[model samples]
Target: MGDIKPLEIADAVLERYRSLEIKEPDSANWTVIAGIVAEDTRSKQLRVVSVASGCKCPGAIVGKEDILKNNADIIKDSHAEVLARRGFIAAILEDKGLLRSDVRFHMFSSSPPCGDASIYEELDGSLRFTGAKLGDWRRESTEQVLGKTRTKPSRSDSIYRSASLSCTDKMIIWSLLGIQGAFIKTKITLSSLIVAAPHPKLIHSLRAALFRGILDRTHTFANEFCIPPPDLSIHVIANHYSGPAHCTKTKPSHLATAWWLSSYSSVERIVAHTGRLLGARSDSTKHSRLSTNALFELSDSQYQTRSEAKINSQYSILRRRLASRLIADFPADHPRKRRLLAHHFANNDIDESVDMRGALPLAKRSKLSPLPAYLLCSLC
Candidate 1:
C-alpha cells in the first residue's frame, strides 16, 4: 500500500466501470458505481476485480433463509458497494489464487458514501463536507438528523421504505466483519478506502465520517470489536461518474445493475438473474450462475449452509466473535441503533468478553442459520 498510488487504483476502477456494456442502460437512469480494485502483480498494473452499480436495498432478505436459498437473483443488498464487495468475494471463493502472494486490494466508490459521511455545508454556494476529525456535523446539519443509524429510503412517496444501510455505514460494518459477509470463512483485508475528491473539504468530511461513523460513535462501538479503521484517501480522478440528477424522469425509480468479472455478462432484472424478462421463472442460463447463492459452495467448509435434502438444517457463522462484540459495543446513548445493526448482522458474543450462559445459545443458533442477527473496533 505504501508503494501503491491511490490515483492508479481509482483510475483503474473508473476505466473498468466505463467499459461495462450496461453502463449506459438508459439516459433517464444513472446509478452510483463502486467496486474493489486490486493490484495485479503479474501485470504490474491495477485492475478492477469486480464492480456494481445500484441503489436498492432488499434488507429483509438478510434474515429470510428460505428466500435466500430459493430465489435466483438472491440480491439482499443491492447497493453498488455491497454487490461489488460480494462480487470480489465470490470471485475469490471461486479461485483462491487471486488472494495469494500479498496482492493488495482497495475499495473505490464513485462518490462519497451516504449517511454520516456525505454531510456537507454550502461553501461558495456549493456543498462541501463539514465534518473533520472529531467534529460533529450531525447535530449542526439541517437536512438530516444526527444520532442513531439511518436507512436510505427506497422512495419519497412509496408506502414502504428500503431497509438497507447507506453504503458508507455498510463499509464501516464490513471493515469489522470482513467483506465476505455470510459467504466465506476467511477474512480479506483492504489497504484503504478511496472516494472521488474534486476538492479538499470533501476529503476532510470523508475522513471524519469513517473515523467518526463507520456505520456512528466510531470510538465506543468499534473499539469493542477490535477491528481497525480502513485507511482513507481522496484522489482527483479523470472522471467521477455520479449519474443523473436527483428526481429526473426515470422508470421504476431507477435502474440498478449488478455484474462482475465472469465468463457470462448478462444484466437482468433483479427478479430475473438468468437473463430473462421480469416475473418469468428462472432457467438454465448464464446469469443464474451469477446469483449469490449459486456462487456459494454448500459442501465446502467455507459455505454457510447445508441444504442437501435430508441433511440437518445447519447454518454457519461467518464472523461469530465480531458479531458478539459489536452487539456489546453500542453506546448507551443509542440503544436502538444497536438493534438496528443487529437486525441485519449476526450476533454471537461467545468470546472471553461474553457471559457464555446467555450468549452461547445465540452463538450456536447463529451458526445454525444463514442469517443470525447481529460492531466496531478502535485501533482502526
Candidate 2:
C-alpha cells in the first residue's frame, strides 16, 4: 500500500483508481461527487476489475453520455459503503504497517432517506426479520418457496404421511412473504447499511464467526484476503427502515439494537487503505498525529453530561434537534410514543446518573460502548 493523499478532487481520484478512470466526477456537482465516489470506489473494490498482468482496454466499457444516468445510484451506494468501511479498517491497517506513511483516514456521512423499523433477536442471538422496510420493502420480500407434494386423504395415513408445518416453520414462511413490509417498520442503523471493522480485537473475533459465511473464503475488500489490524475504524452510510411517518417507537431501537453483519466482501482494499491513512510512523516530535492504539482507545470511550442547562449550553444544536425531532415526533394520542420520546430526549439532553430502572432491556443494549471524547473531539 502507498500513501494516498486526502482525495479532494475528481481528477486526482480518477488518476488514483484505474477502474474509475472513465467515471467522471465533473458532471453533477463533481467536487462533492469526487471525494464520495473516490472513497467508495476504493472501499467497495468497485475499481478493481480483473485484468491480465499487462492488460489494456480496447475500447470504453461504458459510454460517456449515459454513464451517470445508468450508474448513478450504483455509484452512490458503493460510495456510502466505502465511507463506512474506511472508518473501521483504517485503524486496523495503521497498526499492521500495510498502509502508507502519508495519507490520513477520514470518514463522513451523506444525505439519504431516514426513518426507523422494528428489530428482533432470535433465541440464538441472531437477527430475525421482525419487520423492516426500505425503498421497496414489499417487492423485496416476495419469494417462491418449494414445499413437498401431498397425497389425497387415505384410510390409514401414517403421522408422517400427512404434511405438517410447525409454528416456527410457518413463521419462517410468513416472514419470507412479509419481510419487506416488516423490515420497513424498523429503523436502519449505521452498521446495518455498511460493512465496518470493529476494533482489531473485534475483527479477529468476527472472522471466526463469519467463517461460515462467504467473507472467510473470498476476498471482499481490496480484492484480497487480508486480516485487518484491530485498531481501524470503518463505517457505512445507510437509511433507516421506512414506515408510516407518525410512528416513533422504531427510532429508539435503531440506537439500542446495534449489531454488525459478519460477511463483508470488502476487506482487502480497506486494509490497504487503512495502512495508507496511518501515514508515517507516529513521532512525538510531530504535531497532529496519534498512534494506532490511541486512536482505537479514544474511539471506544464515552461522553458524560452533568446538567440539562450545561448540556443545552454546550450542545445547543444537538439538544434542539433531539427535542424537536425526537421528542416532538411523539403525538399526544400515542401514550407509548410520547413517553418513549420524552425518556429518550431526557436521556440524551441531561446527565442523569445511570439507573437500571426505565432503561432499555439488557439484551438490546449496544455492544460497543459509547466512543471516547478525544476520538470525537478532533472530528467535532
Which 10 successive residues of model 2 have the least lDDT summed?
A: 51-60
lDDT of 1 by residue, 169-256 (tens): 4565566555654444455666677776535544654455455555345434456645564443434333444444223446422445
Q: What is the C-alpha lDDT of each candidate?
A: 0.48, 0.21
Question: What TM-score, over all chains together, does every model reach?
Answer: 0.65, 0.22
> Hey, what RMSD does candidate 1 come out at?
8.8
Error of 1 at 133 (Å): 24
Please tell me which predicted candidate would have the highest lDDT against the true structure: 1
Candidate 2 similarity to native, TM-score: 0.22
